[model samples]
Target chain A: MIDPIDLQLIVAIQEGLPIVARPYKIIAGQLDLEEQEIIERLSRLKQQGLIKRLGVIVKHRRLGYQSNAMVVFDMPDKLVKQKGEQISQLAFINLCYLRPRRGELWPYNLFCMIHGKSRELVLQQLTQLIDSCALNDYPYDILFSTRCFKQRGAIYSIDK
Target chain B: MLSILHKQLLNNFQQEFPLSPRPFQDIANILGVSEDEVLSAYRELDKLQFISRIGPVIQPNYIGLSTLIAMQVPGEQLSAVASIVNHFPEVNHNYEREHLFNLWFVLIADDEHHLQTVITGIEGKTGIKTMQLPLLEDYFINLGFQLDLEDNHQSESVCT
Candidate 1:
């Protein structure tokens, strides 16, 4: 459980982490604690695997990359584990997962995403993988992202 | 103060930052700037992204509540479909990845059943099958990024 002080520190960090000489130090200053305390808390959180990362969020569309596709492949239940592993290993796969197919309304079993500079390039890569897997026999669909509403990381707090 | 070069360095921080102490300094050294500058630059970047970040991008499972809902929309009913999905604020993420199940969104419902009920309700109203994939397990890192870039998931983990 987070005490009030920790919660306050968390709130400030959630609002924004400082950017400079020593970020934790700056955060600590805001929270009225020592930098070491902030660092120590983060370390503990890391050990518990609560906090995930500290990094940058880059804008992709503005960078002029052309295409993105949601490639759904129909792999047999038996081969799903093997194929999913293989797909996940590829460098270009930003996101990949397998979901059970629904009633006739939907029939695709596995879903994976491949990204590249353009739709053509992404499609070319998709063709190679689809053909190589001989996955044409199974039913599937491809839906490219038309819009994005929220793409930032999920913010969390102890209070529900 | 951050120089233009340091800002450029933040542009290159990427999804996976190399693990090291004085990590920002390491970046500064590579970019020909002082550690202080790199530190400050990170703050500015965090402010822009609306979260604190650095190291260990936590898997979605770590914070709990995750599900994927895919709905097939009649070509003409797309707007209505989106409005229905948008009704629930828990639908933190809505996307248009390429596929026949054209509309995909992440629903952070109170639980798995809640996620299913919403999808089912949508399907009942629209008559198209809605595939609800409650994340079974997470081993693959799937997050959309940009041209030659993967989005940085390092937001502050108020995971306490």
Candidate 2:
């Protein structure tokens, strides 16, 4: 668990970093902490694997990646780790994970996201992924997103 | 249309962004452009909604608990159900996908208890059962996207 001050720092920057000459310094002013402290804490947090990345957050759809599909596969439990690692290394696949199967309601255990400029392009990439990964035997589903109701960064409550 | 500098900035700086007092300046030095040029380009990118923000993408389940949830809602009641789910700050990403369990969303909370409470509250409000798919393993190392700017087409609005 992180300390209170570190948690406060996460809360401050979770939304975004100010786009300025000295963004960290600006955050330092807000938290009444030294600029170096903010930088050091962020570095440590990043090294500790709490922070995945620190950079530009591109809106893929705006960049013409309109075709987004969540492709899920029902793989043998033993092969999940190996298959997940192989599928994730592909350049087209953005995110991959292993999730629990909800019995008959949901049987998919492996999931990955692919975004492309068109549906045709996405499907073609999916075909390539299947061929390359030798995943013909697994039952999979492609759930293309129809609409986005809401999208934003996660907000963690500091009160807790 | 994106300028060369704009494309470079978008493609190259997706991750490992300069963490310093004058990060824009640092980026400027690397790109062989003036600091003002880099700053203005980023501002333009933000205004155009090409980039969401400059911030740390926290690793999942690090600072708080989160899970992927899927709910099967009646076709007509989809909007209403989504609105109810969106009311909670814990629900960050909510989407309508092409599947029986159509509404897929992500919920993040300060702890496991809070996470369960939000899930129950959503079910209570919408009167629909939600299948929680918590992450069992993350196979992908999220090295931010290497955007292909040249292939990008003008995006048509997908949001209702």
Candidate 3:
């Protein structure tokens, strides 16, 4: 579990780091802590795997990655780990996960996201992924994102 | 229409963004550009919504609980249901996809109870059943995407 100060620090910068020469210094000032302390804490968090990534969060759609498809597969339970790892290694696959199936309503247990410049490119990549992985037998579906109602960094309430 | 400097910053600095007193200056030194140039480029990127932010991508279920949820809202009520779902601060990403379960979102909360509360609240408000698909295993360690800016085919549709 993270301490209170660390939680506060995470909350402070979770939204974003100020786009300035000394962003850390700005965060330090906000928390009334030394700049070095803020840096060290963040470094420690990253090391602990609490912070998965620390960097530029690009808006892919605006960067010409217009096709966003969430590809899910209903794989045999045992094959999920192997197949998920294999699919995650592909350069075009942005996100991959193993999720639980909810009976017949949701039969997919594996999910991956592919973002590309166009629908054709995304489809080609999906085809390549399927052929290379030998996933012909597994039932799969590609749900292309039509609209983004909202998108933002997660907000953590300290009160919890 | 991204400048060379902008492309370099977007592609290379997605991960390992400097954690120092003058982080932008560090990036500037590496890119062979002035600190002000890097800062302004990033400022413009943020202004144009090309980059969302420079911050830590917290690991799921690390600081708080999170789940991927899907709901099948009728086409007519899609916008209204989305508005209700977007009302909660916990709901970070809400998207309309092409599927039976057309509306999908991600919710993060301080704990399991809070997460469930938000889910239940949304169900009550929208009157649509939600299928929670929390992460059983994450196959990829997010290193950030390495963008290929050479073939820049910007989409005609504006995503707002």
What does candidate 1's lDDT look like per residue over B1-160, in tens digits? 3346534654566553433435577787888878876766666655554223553354565444677887767768777777776666566557755456778877664455655776677677667776777665443643324223344332232211
lDDT of 3 by residue, A1-160 (tens): 7899999999999889998778898999999999999999999998888899899998888778988999999999989999999998899998999999999988999999999988999999999999988899999999999999998878887895
Candidate DockQ scores, in order: 0.29, 0.78, 0.76
lDDT of 1 by residue, A1-160 (tens): 4456655655566534444545677777777888778777766654565544445554344334435677876778888877777777666676778777776766767888765667787888887777766666777677777666445445545445
What candidate 2 gets wrong by more than 4 Å, as runs, is: B156-160
lDDT tens readout by residue for model 2, B1-160: 9999999888888778887878899999999999999999999998888888888888899878999999999999999999999999899779999999999999998889999999999999999999999998999988887788885686856342
List the TM values for chain B, per candidate: 0.56, 0.95, 0.93
A69: Cα error in model 2, Å: 0.5
Alpha-carbon shift of residue B100 in model 1 (angstroms): 4.5
TM-score of 1: 0.72
Candidate 2 residue pairs in clash (backbone atoms < 3 Å): none
Tens-digit lDDT track of model 3 for B21-122: 898999999989999999999999888888888998888887889999999999999999999999898997899999999999999988899989999999
Q: Which ten residues in a row have the lowest lDDT in candidate 2 chain A?
A: A151-160
Of the pair 1 and 2, which is ahead by lDDT?
2
Q: Whose DockQ is higher: candidate 1's or candidate 2's?
A: 2
Pairs that collide in candidate 3 are none
